[model samples]
Every structure is written in structure tokens, then in C-alpha cells.
Target: MAQPMAELADLLTRLGTWTTLYIDGPDGSPAPERDARRTSIRDRMLRAGTPEPDVEVALELLTDDGPPAPSSQTILVRDGTVRSSWTSSTPGRGSGRRS
Candidate 1:
């Protein structure tokens, strides 16, 4: 908790646009459905001006096996670098920054 907040505060001090993604659990979805969700997220991020490198990194971190245990994950990227990421037990909507 405190560690994540501290990392976020450190990230905020940098001078670059931030791209954040909040992903919900897989919720027992099939593999194909989860793949579709990944594709959708990738497309949306690319359309929203996120760099390809950052998007790839985000996707890699977000991926997991076996339905993912009803958790939410947040990823923060800046200048093609992933500065912070954390997972929570609570569910989160699949959301991303516009730019």
C-alpha cells in the first residue's frame, strides 16, 4: 500500500505523459475471450497515442493464467517505461488513459 503510493508519487515527479490502464479479472472467461480482450486493449491504447513499446510492456504484465483469481491490476507507464504496477483483490473495469 504505502510502497505503491510511494512509487506513484515518484512517477508523478517525472515530466512525461502518463498512460495508465486498469484491468479487471478474467472472471472465468474462455481463452479466446481473454485474447479478444487483450486485442481490444492493445487497439485502444494504440489509438489513444500510447507508444507501442509501452503498450507491449503493459500487456505482458497484465497477462496471467487460469482466470486470474478475481483481481484487478493497474499499470502506469511513462515514455515507454513501466514505472509502477500493482494488483488488488477488488475488481476493476477495463479502463485506460486517452493520451
Candidate 2:
């Protein structure tokens, strides 16, 4: 079983390498080499074992930059178990409330 902190670190490693490319945005066009580098980073993340759900959650948290909503309930995990459940305003939202 993976520790929560380790799981978070693996997820961050994937996000740190993410990139994208756009041709001739409002500002100006980027050189082909820049686009290629962006693509390479994206590819690497895709190849990594990062879950798609985790990626979506990370993007929402980072880009929205808003206060988190309250958690609706608590989760209890038994020893040696691989999964746990909790409730919140949003479905699948774990009840790891922050102080």
C-alpha cells in the first residue's frame, strides 16, 4: 500500500512536467522547438502512472484558486485496506478536512 504523502509526491512529479503548445497566440507565435519541448513534457506525464482523476483535481485546485468547500463527512480506513470512502458536497470528495 502507498502512503498518502508518497501518492501526493508522485502526482506532483507528473504535474511539474506538464506542458502544452499553441501556434500564434494573441501575443505571438512560438518557435517550433518550443512547441516540441512542450509536447515532450506532456508526453512524459501521459506515460507516467498518474491517474486522470488526480490530474483533473489538481488542475481545478490550482486554476480556480478558491477556498475549499466543507467536507460533509468522515472516512475510516481499516489496516491493510487499499481503499476508503467519505462524503462531502461533491461526490467522491474525501473527508480530509483542513484545520
Candidate 3:
């Protein structure tokens, strides 16, 4: 059986994908200004013939901000799991210049 955290991850993944489908404009078109990319693990999984539930579980584990740090090699263990890594910028630490 999977853990609660894993379950939450799966839900979030599905929600993320469904959210993307409801966005403005048709698929393959660029999102309008001020809009953000809403693609999710579910979208990728469907494209690669993977099960949505499995993809969700893997995304949950890979995104957990626990020790060891997240990385691309963090095997998702799903059929179409696309392993990726990202570095976010810290807020409030700008170049100290006026706009």
C-alpha cells in the first residue's frame, strides 16, 4: 500500500493536468501573456502510455523536499516517468537596482 503523502502527490498531479486542459486557448498554442504553463505529470504519462496513478505516486516521491535533495536521476519508477530537476531562485535577493 502507498503512504498518504504518496496519495496526495497523485491527486495533485491529476489536478495539475486537468487544470491545464481547462486553460485558455487550444492545445499546442502558446499561452497568452500573464498565463502560466499548467502541464502535469498526468499529461506526460498519457502521452507515453503510462498509468496516471503510477505517475502521480512517483511525482509525489520525487517532489518531496526531504533530505538527499531532488535530482533528475530520482527514478520515478513509472512507465512514462520523465525525471527532471529544477532550481528555484530565492526571493528578496535581487541585484539591488531600481526598475
lDDT of each: 0.77, 0.33, 0.37
TM-score for each predicted model, relative to the true structure? 0.77, 0.24, 0.29
Order candidates by TM-score, high to low: 1, 3, 2
Candidate 2, overall lDDT? 0.33
Write candidate 2's Cα lDDT for 26-50 as tens digits.
1222567545644563455457744
The per-prediction CA RMSD against the true structure, in angstroms, equals: 5.0, 15.2, 14.3
The runs of at least 3 residues in candidate 2 whose Cα sits more than 4 Å from the true structure, single-residue gaps closed, are 1-30, 53-99
Model 2 residue 16 lDDT score: 37
Q: What is the C-alpha lDDT profile of model 1 across 1-99, one tens digit per residue?
A: 224676678778888688899777557778898888999999999999889988998898875642475677778877777778777775444444232
Q: Judge candidate 2 at residue 89 and give its lDDT.
A: 41
Give candidate 1 misplaced runs (Cα > 4 Å): 65-70, 91-99
User: Which pairs clash (backbone N, Cα, C closer than 3 Å) in model 2?
Assistant: none
Error of 1 at 87 (Å): 0.5
Per-residue lDDT tens digits for candidate 3, residues 8-35, read 4764575223211111122333444212
